[model samples]
Target chain A: MKIETLFIDRAIRPCEEIDYIIQSTSLEPEYVENSKVVYDHVNLSDDPITKGKQTLYITENHGAVIKKCPGTSHYTCCDYTILHTGTFCTMDCSYCILQAYFHPPLLQYFVGQHKIDAALDEIFKENKTFRVGTGEFTDSLIWDKISNQPAKLVRKFADQARARSRSSNNNFSILELKTKTVNIDSLKDIDHNRKTVVAWSLNTPKVIKSEERGTASLSARLKAAKECERWGYRVAFHFDPIVIYQGCEEDYKEVIKSIFEGVRVDKNVDSSSDGVIKQSLGILPESIVWISIGTFRFMPQLKQIIENRFPKSTIAYGEFITGLDNKMRYFKPLRIKIYQKIVSFIRQYAPDVLIYFCMEDEEVWQKTIGFFPKKEGQLGAMLDRSVMERCKAC
Target chain B: MLNLQTTISNSALLKKRVKQVCLDAIDLSDESFKISSDNLFFSGNKSSSDNSLSNLTNLSNLALSIRLTGLINPIVLREIDDKYIVVSGFKRVSAMRSIGMRETPASILSHLDFDKDKTYDFRFYEVQSALIAISDNAFSRQLNVMEQARGVRLLKRFCSSYDIAQNSPAIFNVNMGESLINMLDDIANMPLSLHELIESDKLSMSSALKFKQYGYDKSLIESFATLFSKIKCSLSKQKEIITNIHEIAAREEISASDLIESKEISQILDSQSDNCSSNVNDENQKANLIRSILFNRRYPNLFKAKERFSNNLKMLNLNSGMKSDIKLDPPADFEGRDYTITLKFSTVEELAKKANILSALTKNPLFGDITD
Candidate 1:
């Protein structure tokens, strides 16, 4: 995210990291005592949500630097760990929960390498399994220019014994940097050690143009994923917040076709040629670790914000009713039909992809993919096994 | 920085002898006495436009009061060169004018709060007079939302919105948030028909602001105001209808005004009208019909799914309301796997019997079709 103005907390000690961000964005620093100053500053604007994206607040995270994923109740959680590095993103999608997630949404970049390293030390020191990612609350690569945390995280995970009183390879942790942007230049030369999986959120080209504002194109994101794989970093793809419209099923079918064509398949798969899947799979290295699909769902309060901010957007007008988790989700049959099509499309191309649903429940899993995560193992345990097997993590 | 009330009271203006003046000398068109908008009457909603800028409202009662005794409270006024302006008692003057009593006992303030000649303190006195006008009605009765909004519009000129929000209840008879100051301002600046919708509780603050952001033509707002005034729905219902209409219009690439004023919708609305020969007397039923139309237009398949689910639910006769003591509930919105069965029994034997009955229901294929 190229911030137009940088707001620094006055209590924050000046560091080279903060200086680098200010210099990179070419925005003069305005220090404030606390958040009220930033709140009042944005509250004065005609559009606070849009203005917040342009202004970046460089502040310290006084709370836990690493938190568990805030998975809603009554939904299957993937037992993911959240690297609470930041709070909001610059990309403007109509279906973004962050718009209602944050009260008066602001682009907050918590800057302190020591604190982040300290948080990671706990995970690295503990002899436990973790499937951690930074894309839970914000886009991971939106700040590759201003911050090299993703690259630094790659280095930290590679050197597994950096921070530990008890060193054991049994403690497995993979850092996933998921983004809608193609800001992977700094990550090119790093020795990721298969410890980092660079993932891109995939959507149709039509959605990318109309709804995903200021985001990389679908082709660009796929190209970046290929480059990340070329740089020896395992990659993943998420078709999260898949908006449903008239032609969305066919559009998503094309996207699935592009992903399987753009990325190489598993090495052990028979070089089968079903006219559509007849890509060169023999010489290329396998890159995809997993693919997650979650149809669009949001909190009810986001409806008004979307209506006001994205007046032209019709995504919120879907056949939605309150779910058990109290979120506005597409009707069950509607979600099941779409999920069935998407899962079938993915299975046709790469049967070994280890496809998973992001937040759907057991019944949906049974109807869509014919297997429930609970019946196999817990969803988290399943993901933990997949990540560990693919990345060779403990 | 003069205290306006103290200035009016201590000044010799009220102490001077009250006199009757020609009503023609007063400029009734000057809206200095009204915190309410003058032209807030939407075209088709004349039946319920009780506050249609008519200072002559409830004239018979005021005239009866005047006829019984006399002008017990002399109407407060201020002179403007050759003419006068009713500062506080607009209805009284209009009543007297209607009753053919060309003049009444009046307290003409030579030291005017609302001065005809603009002076250095002209804007300050206008603010004072606007507050006085709002306080007059607000103290007697609850000022409706639009009047309160118009009061905000009037007082916003002299103070910060923070001050208005902090001191709104005493002046406008309604509590307001500092954030809603913009909506209040919109109420003042919006067209008269939209104002009428708000005053009559047809449109809501949130919905009005949505239309304001749409920047659509005034006719669309007018059409919704007209429809809502006729239907007289709740604030939340108004929001839902407007939001659905906009979404459908946007998706179909049709003008929202044309969609609202379409022949089908008009026929549905006219179905419940007094003049129409149709027997549809309930506006709420008409509201449901409109909602169903929009629902079907938006998602034909989902509507069919809801219908199928409803039909399947009807097949299960184990509902507690009809002879049975069991309550079966699908998961909220039918989006999850678990279905709940509640058995209400006062005795253990009854519980066992209900349990056995519930067990018997397990074999019913229609019980499973609700999930399907």
Candidate 2:
């Protein structure tokens, strides 16, 4: 398990033989000598098309696949499907638990296409109506560089005509590849109907630069999301782990404002079955186009785990209290204020787009939205159920 | 014994008599019943022995009662010695009695005598009362999800066919709501021993609810309930057990149910009857159990010990600023010295409290054995 080093800059250095040209992180050691040392080659593979072992560090989580849906947690907004890709983020956000969520904390992509295809086939065959996403463990589209990205997933989904038809409704969507990066080149020409939501994990620019290292600028990611929307692809944006810092109001306000400016909300939301208000204006007819907003939340115990594992995390230090589920609760007033500002701003522009919160409690939900969902899974499930019902009637 | 069972259906007649007695004007009498007022007012007892002479005083702080002032409240009658026992008062009659009269006119009917053979034998009534005593006040006060579910199920079954004005669904709905609320408390109040049943696969919510159903067998259920509660509280306190929802459920099964249910196998299956109403309250109760444990970390003893230590620390006149510098000497009985050094308190108050409590334990025999 001896570690090796190679400086992988554009020019070959005779003195240094490094495996990777370590990109944007404060993680580089002067003399990297551990088995877990990350090889940071900008180009790991000689042939771009032929998939090499992704520089993305991946470990097979042979752990039980049937996990207690984290979506059941009130704070959790997004329904997780499967983590097709593993820990492979170029960004080194201080608060990102993926630093500790993965051991050896390297950017490795697992090329287990065969396993994934079989898994998806089984998932599609068994479930008539399921809302799943691959962005659980890894950024869904971040691995587009190493693998074919969601396009392969899109192709597989397009092939599932029988499965789609048998679903009794068109509520079936394959991959909601959420990302903070502006890499939509791979997604530009996919069949628009092949349920792939190219999601963006947007944060305030202050957070992005200070915390998220090697990630795209906020404008670039939004522009890319806008492009995907224009190309007839339904898009989603996530303000997850939205850091509640001073001036977060202005920061989040700008993000909401920019989103409406780039992505035409009216046209895209006009056709949505959910009748969600468009936070922006003028887009194609789509179903339930929206944004999921949430302040940073995690288990109280996860704080220690993060500190022990990823010691340099700065994002874990905002004031937190124990929530109802007894996980660390962000100050309610602070969270509510942020949510109110964000929702108001969103309502001002993309008033018709569905705006929801993830992993938030009933109290928070009721405060943010006018009412709380009837049942726990009802909110997320209702959107897909209504969409499916409408498509079936048609 | 004048039989009143035939008249049980005539709730209206019972109500009228209750109203007449309650409304009859009389002056307040002193210390009429031998039983304690606390027992009579709050002790959810249904029957009392005739000759036992409980000096139970009726509640006399009467202004206008809400029920009587608004409308007639129904009164339940128990037959006693050819006389009717008003389980609760029609407000008007109770008001007259409080106004000071001895034997203000009563609606006489026979008290409930489940065992007619022992009629007029006050011993039988006392024995029956003891048999019917639903819960032991000495045991742990709060019930966990499983325990509360069993208690509610038992009460529901016992009261379902009772001659209450409401039907089963109506009663079930009310009780189910209560159970749902208590279920959250159960999670909040679950002992660490039971947490193993929760955190591990040993106990499932379905099974835990079953345990709650069988809690009617108070002697058996109470013992296990106390044991599991302690286990749950202890696990959370010790920080030894997993607090995850599935894990807590599983662990609870292992420590609480698996071992106990096998011994009481018949009761376990019997309690898991499908006849129970699957209403919103019951469903939410069960859900809250899972949800609470999953989201909330259940280190049961931590807070209690921390509270105790904080109380002890408060005795010292030490300022808040001087808190962190205080050092604690470990007790002689304490097992690992490494624990003394490495133990990190969640807050400065916790550190200060622990330090003060430990330092004050110098006279204790276990003080020498303290770790680190």
TM-score, one value per model = 0.85, 0.42
After aligning candidate 1 to the native by TM-score, how far in Å is the CA of A231 from where it should be? 1.6
Q: Write the per-residue lDDT of candidate 1 for residues A1-394, one digit (tens) a residue.
A: 3468779999989888888888888878899988998987776798887878888899999898888887776788787889988878888887788877776688988988888887887787767677788898899998786887778888887776333324545656888999998889899887666888888899988888888988987766776677677777788889998888889999999888777666333222222324343233211225678899998888888887887888788878788878888888888888989999998898888777778988888889899989887743388887777777778632
Q: List the residue pairs that clash in candidate 1.
A: A1-A142
Evaluate every candidate with DockQ and list the scores.
Answer: 0.49, 0.01
Question: What is the iRMS for every candidate structure?
Answer: 2.2, 16.6
Give the alpha carbon lDDT tens digit for every residue of B8-41 in model 2: 2332322123423433232223211111122233
Highest TM-score: give the candidate number: 1
lDDT of 2 by residue, A1-394 (tens): 1112222222222221122223322124243332233442323434211111124332333444322245544344445456444544655555665644554344544444556677677767664555556676666766565356367776666566445676564445445678877767778777646466678888888888776776777766766676677766667778887887658889888877777665434433234425554444333324325578888877665665454434344455564556655556565656777898888887887666677787776656677777776565677675565335322311
At residue B86, give the lDDT of candidate 1. Answer: 70
Candidate 1, residues B169-198, lDDT tens digits: the string is 766777888878767787677778887666
TM-score of 1: 0.85
State the lDDT at A298 in candidate 2: 74
What is the TM-score (0 to 1) of candidate 2?
A: 0.42
